[model samples]
Target chain A: MSEKIVQTSKEKQEETSQQISRQWKLSTSLGIMFLVIFMAITVLNTFAPDFMTFKVIGNFTVTYLYSVLLLYIASWSIVLYYVIKVTTLEGASI
Target chain B: MIEIPTAIGMVVLMVIITMGIAIFARRFGSSAAEFYVANRGITAFQNAISLGGSYMSAASFLGVAGLVWLYGYDGIWYASGFFGGYVVLLLWIAAPLRRFARYTVADFAFGRWHSKSLRMACIVFTLISMMFYVVPQMVGAGDLLGVLLGWDYTFAVVVSGILMTLYVVVGGMRGTTYNQIFLCIVLWSAMFITTILALMHYGWSYNALLGDIGARIEPGIWLDPLNSFALALGLVLGTAGLPHILIQYYTNPSGKAARWATVGVLFIIGTFYMMTPIVGFAGRAILGDAAGKNTVLPLLGQALGGEPLMGIIVGGAFAAIVSTTAALLIACTGAIAHDLYVGLINPEASDRKQVWIAKVSTIAIGLFTIGLGLAFKGYNVAFLVGLAFAITASTFFPMLFMGIWWKDMTDKGALAGLILGGASAILIITTNIMGMHTLQNPSIISVPLAFLAIYFVSKWAGKMPDDIDDIMHQMHSLHSDIK
Candidate 1:
């Protein structure tokens, strides 16, 4: 009876760790996806320099509005999302 | 506006305070853990501030502002890449490395593979990347004293070198951490004062600073999609690969706190970086192209608020050099004493012996850094920093990414990638320095090649470690799971 209980507990632990990794995978993917969009904008800025300098609003160019402003906000947001999501992951008690 | 005597006095006071903190923190440095990661009891907030302090070297504080002042929109990209890197660390590298919770990057590889050669490889690469890193700080520190105190360059280098070595050898990581925390706040506040004064002068119009569009960019910077992309990639990934910066994460209390601290660093540093470009733009607006190379921040501070303000800014700049050089010296000490000596040469060594060797190694490595700095004094400081990042991005980032996330990675594969990746990156930089005009950065080519080297070599080489599942669980899951 004791042996059976030990086996059951070991199986349960494995399942829980697997669940933790899966959740990390989901959150990490979201962070990477956000990065892709940011990098895509950087690519456009380099390839389309003239367009990047286009007056988006009040003499501010695309590069300034996006690279200067949006980059900071996006990086901060995604990382915040990551931490919040990870800390709440089941079995990631940490 | 540039008051030499006041500046010298302020810097001298700052150094005295830094020495005091190091000496006081020595009580906490009796053991290896206390010396290395502050016994892993550092609060997330403290870790965050030191991370910002240790990271905002002369490279970020002075280099970025100078780049933006000279290159305009093109230069802002470096700061963006620098901040963008924290996201990568937060997403992938920070938690796992903290979970491993070892002394150095070399320890991670050795623990994973149980291979002495692999551990030695990491130590070599760590030292090499660090050597590349120290040159820039030495160069910057010498130049800073030269400008602020009118001291000769070599004399300034020697004085700064001895002062940095004294504190770290006595106090260890605990001392360095305290100094970094104090110094980063001082430096950031100095930048803050300069920014507010600049904006106030312009009636708080950010766009007013941007009015001179035609003269924004000099010839051929942040252009050429290939070059820009390469430079940006090196800048972004480089932060994650940096040994000193990543080591700070281990100071956090847990994996979760490490994640939080990583994000905190982005915000702390993010605000400082944002101000850098503004100060740069203000310099361009006020002084045009005559603002002097790598001296934009001090010059702008003097112009806006005159001598007292410039004195504070320059004093903060001195702190920047000292804090970063101390941080790097501690890292070099780790490469020698922790990673090489204890981990390799004398695995059974006592804790008391370990601490003693660490102090000796600190002096040796500190002197070596100063010697290299004196030798490489003529190179541009910013370019040297970029070279350090590129080599790190090429070698370590690929290895850590695969090791942390992929369980199938073999020791043989990692070793192959470590050597090939490091060699190719250095080859390009060295050749470029000899005037081949090799791409200004090597990350564009080297990162992919390094990843491929590890991938193909893993498929073709040594068997995976027997405890791969246990390692993965330890790195990815909660501590309870390992039980």
Candidate 2:
């Protein structure tokens, strides 16, 4: 009976460790994705001046004001998604 | 121009109000922890407002507007980068840093690495960055006084320094936080009203103003890809490493609170930055090139709303300078009293003694900054702030990032990285000051070199600490198991 109890406890520890590793990987990937998207947009606005300067409205350019707004919204969405997912996961575990 | 008597009255009223808040907060700061982190009891919303107030230095208020007025589209790059930095801070540093819950960044470094040398290195870099950061606030104070009350630059710098020192010495972190929140409300109201009035002057047509600005912007000058990228990179990464700003996280109740506060800060700062362009564009169109660059916003206020409105704006500007200067002084005091004196010299010192030492150091730092500010009068505030950011980005950012995430970061590696990164940044900035303008923002090169130094040195010279696994677990864990 004691042997069986020890074996079960070992298995549970392994499972917990695996779950943590998976969460870490997912979180890191999400972070990297956000950074890449942010840097790419910045690069586009910088290198492609004419494209950014394409007049969208009367005086607003594609890259100057509008693109920045889009990037801001996208970044915030990414963060919000991460925050919700992580909090839910922690809640479920608890 | 603003009448001298009105400006003096406005400034005096602001000083009295701030001092009153400090006196009220004096009771909360009886212990070292209370002085440093407000006993870790500040709520997310209040901390967010205070953070916004501290972050929007004179550089943001006067400097960004001036740059926008002078350079048009190229100038908005500063605001874009400054706002984008919070995104990085929220995702990368905020949660883990708060989990550590140390008094200062040096304390964090020492705890993580168990190396006195690394802690000393952090203290040096912290002091350098804080001193450089305070210079711009001093300069802004002098400029505001000169424009408003017609005072000599040196006299203005000295007065501003003394007022800020008094605030930090009396109230410490609690006082600074309350005063910052009050100042931010005043600042935001003034900016909103000014932006509205300026738009009204242009008949509420953003397109008309944009059309004028677009016509004036020289082709290719406004959108140099390399310079723009450099500016953005420096601002975003540099913000991640600022000692004074990072210390604010410790005031939160928990890591989660810190994260939420950053989210709040994002919105608060974004709204303020958005109004800057309107102010800048309007100033350019109405005030023209005749208004001195640093005085554009005040002059624009007078033009749109007359002397009474200008007085309000000047009061807001002084508040911005004082709030930022107080934060910097507090950070400097922490480095001396908590990090050096307590951590290194006398670990057994009582809380009362530590607080006393912090107050003394605050006054000393204030006097030193006053002299530097006087010497650098008429220098561009934004440019000086950029250099401060570069130094911090190259030195502290790499160390902190690696220390928190990478388990293999050895003490030796951290020390090497800090020395190399800091030295390279100073050399490049000094050379730029001496007219070698090729490397204006050293982070573009220095950060990578610092990382490389850490990586190679750790691989060859030393092994990770024995307790690193536990440290890593603590940093990565969702909640504290101890509680």
Candidate 3:
């Protein structure tokens, strides 16, 4: 009975490892993507100031309101939604 | 100037409500587990509110607004980093940590490597980081009280410290958690109403205000990319390393609840942070440079709607300071009691003894912080908070992330990383404080050095625990059946 229990535990551990790996892959990729987007926006706003400084909306420049909104959407809303979706899906199916 | 009576009334009311909840929570806390983590019974929503309240701090409530009021677009980057940190927490650290760790981050480090010395190092760093973090909140409390109620700085600090200590001593994590939830609501509502009133002064259009602020920006001030990147990086990485913030995960019922709490934190804090920029912009456009920069929001409240609104805003800011200070105090107390006294000196200590030690530690830390807060009365609250973040980012972030993800991490590497990272951060910040302007954001250099220290030292030392694979497996496994 103990041998069978150990065998089942090993199987569960392996299954958990696979699930965690998949989750890590998704989350890390999304995190890196967001970091890159953040860095890109910072660089664009820094070096090519004119491009981002131009009036994109009514008195709002590309750097002022637009970049912030873009970051919120891409980094926060999109990334978080996917992270929750992926993690919760695994939880549900399990 | 604030209307003394009204502001005093509102602040007193907030304190009464907060302490009432805390005293009520005391009934649920008796053992060390109950004291430290509320027996891990907090729901996702309550945990979220508590996390939001603890995370926001006076640094976010007043410092961000003050910075934005002072620095234009550059200041908003601070808010961005603050908000972005939760994303990192949500994806990387939150769930896995909740699943693996029982009490504190030190528990995980010790559990992984079975090193008493490593746990001691964690205690040292956690105390240093938390004490450093607490001073600013205490200072903000003193400043706000001095302004609002005509109290002396020392009196204000003592009052705030004693009140926070009472909450933690009486109620422990349960009390602190509920108090934090009430504080977050008060803080968010205050900021939201103030922002709306401020926007109304500009005819209710965010675009109009943003456009005007954008148009009025001085050439080089609004677009410094390097500093912006450094500030943003520090806020993001530093948050992941915060001892108080990370311990909030343990308050939730499960790893899944912790993750959901992070989601709730994201929306709750995101809304509060969004309001900061409006306050900053409005303060700049309407009040301009006339008001004391740090007191811009409070002054704006007075200017817009008189004593009643200003009292509400001041009350909210005070709650932000107290809630954050309470959280930091508890974190520090845990390090002393659980990590040091119980963990190292007296491993056989009973839970009742541990709880007593924690309560005593809370009082000691509170008194120590009050002294530090009064001494550093004139320092910028935001900048001081930034320095604390840099220290955490350098010391804790590298060790934690590597420990969680990499199987090759050794006790030797973690120790070297913590010592070197902490030393470098302190040296750089001290020099910067003492007039060396080149290394303002020490994390840009210190964090990388810490990571390299861990990486290179781990490779060279090549002496990991035999059960490292098993430890890693445990950390990765979603279920907690191994124990």
Candidate 4:
């Protein structure tokens, strides 16, 4: 296979400076979104001990489903959202 | 003399197969790419498996279940930090890092700053993290063998150390990559088999299992909110800074490929983590109070499916240790041989000479870590891994984060952050070991301090790389190409 370093065209360069800020905004904003939810769950699990232990379904309590199961679901949803959005916004994926 | 034949048989086969692959890879892996990064042609799926395999270690495979059995919800919350880390990587670090780095994290640091001292500082931080990282796996491997296979701990550690050193020297990264992929399959399959059997034993009801566990163990018994908070901080940030984990992503053919692979990594590890708690709860409900902290998986295997099941989990444990220890060795070799010997001492060195240095360095590192393992017998495996992550979070996480995004990041700023972050973290860990015991994980204090150090020092230092804009374009733009 042949190989060469990437050289951005002048038009692409202008486009990319805009893209970088947009991508950074998207990546970081989504990243912060995930971190905040995780930390909040941690605090709830830590301090609100009685609230976390209330059984809502069968033996599955708020701590088990909301803190762990839902947190995992949210984490995956964020990861997939990032992938799909990046591909849609750009012709190529970053 | 007593032995668990099923476990011994399967584990022996695993060792033989990996040993065979290492020898086979050594014969043909002559080029820089072949030895260093699997010829830089690993597919997304393969890289994903390797990434999961490298990260799983004994801590994830065995310790997660053990913790959940012992501490209930508190355990999974602490362990989830490992998964929490990749979110940071997927967002901020993965792509730009792959595009910017050539061989190791030092390459990325030096590429940004063009300072030999900064590169050496990168190596120092990498070495400290890798040393802390490698010992736990080594000690875990020895302990697992001694408990299950009945081997002497010293003999078990020495043999595994010799095997790993020889495998790394022969196979390099290419061999490590393939071994990691296969080992990942073995370990994940073991988790699947054990968890499925436990569910089946409990009438296949998730509710039934949780009902039993909640009735038996009070949720309040597992609460340590402060320690959990600190641990979560360390794992979430420290994972992004791991030296062994960082280099594997750079092995991808392109920056985009690395990002794509991470999606799979999250899914794979996420699935594995979800299953671990089941095994933990199952062990508690079924075994009553018979489960030991790290022995939950193997014991659950015995209770769930007898000796064959136990064998698979035991073999899976060995695979987890071997894959992680080998990755650490290769990372150590890259630091000493590729970064130091080739980058500084012999810039004009031949390909064969570079490979030779890497082999010698692997031997030296293997001996040093094995000695540490034998000396610190019976140390908690998960605690050491968490400490390693905390230090990495304190140091490398800051350097990589700012170096990629912040344009004015100067060499002096980078070095200052590295020293301050790494030294402070080590001080905390040392004092904690010496009974200071003030904080379980210091990342809560150290991570923000390191980030602040980089920012203020860079602002005051007043010199930035001339090609900062071009480098940024290479990392962020679609037109940025890879060779």
Question: Ten consecutive residues with minimal summed lDDT in candidate 1 chain A?
Answer: A1-10
Docking class of 1: acceptable
> All predictions: root-mean-square deviation over Cα?
3.6, 4.5, 3.0, 2.3
Candidate 3 chain B minimal-lDDT segment of 10 residues: B214-223
Per-model TM-score versus the true fold: 0.94, 0.92, 0.94, 0.95
Residue A25, candidate 4: C-alpha displacement in angstroms:
0.4
Candidate 1 similarity to native, TM-score: 0.94
User: List-wise, what DockQ does each model earn?
Assistant: 0.34, 0.20, 0.36, 0.48
| Real interface contacts reproduced by model 1, as a fraction | 0.43
Enumerate residue pairs that collide in model 1. none
Cα lDDT tens digits, model 2, B196-277, are 9988887999888877765543224554666566667788888989998999888888777787888888878878888887
Error of 3 at B71 (Å): 1.4
Chain B TM-score, all predictions listed = 0.96, 0.96, 0.96, 0.96
How far in Å is the alpha carbon of B253 misplaced in model 3? Answer: 1.1
Which prediction has the highest TM-score against the true structure?
Answer: 4
Model 1 C-alpha lDDT versus the unseen true structure: 0.80
Best lDDT among the predictions, by candidate number? 4
- lDDT by residue for model 1 (A4-81), tens: 111224564586467546756865687668668667766776567788778776668777777777888877877887
Off by over 4 Å in 3: A1-17, A92-94, B211-223, B380-383, B481-483
lDDT for position B321 in model 3 = 84
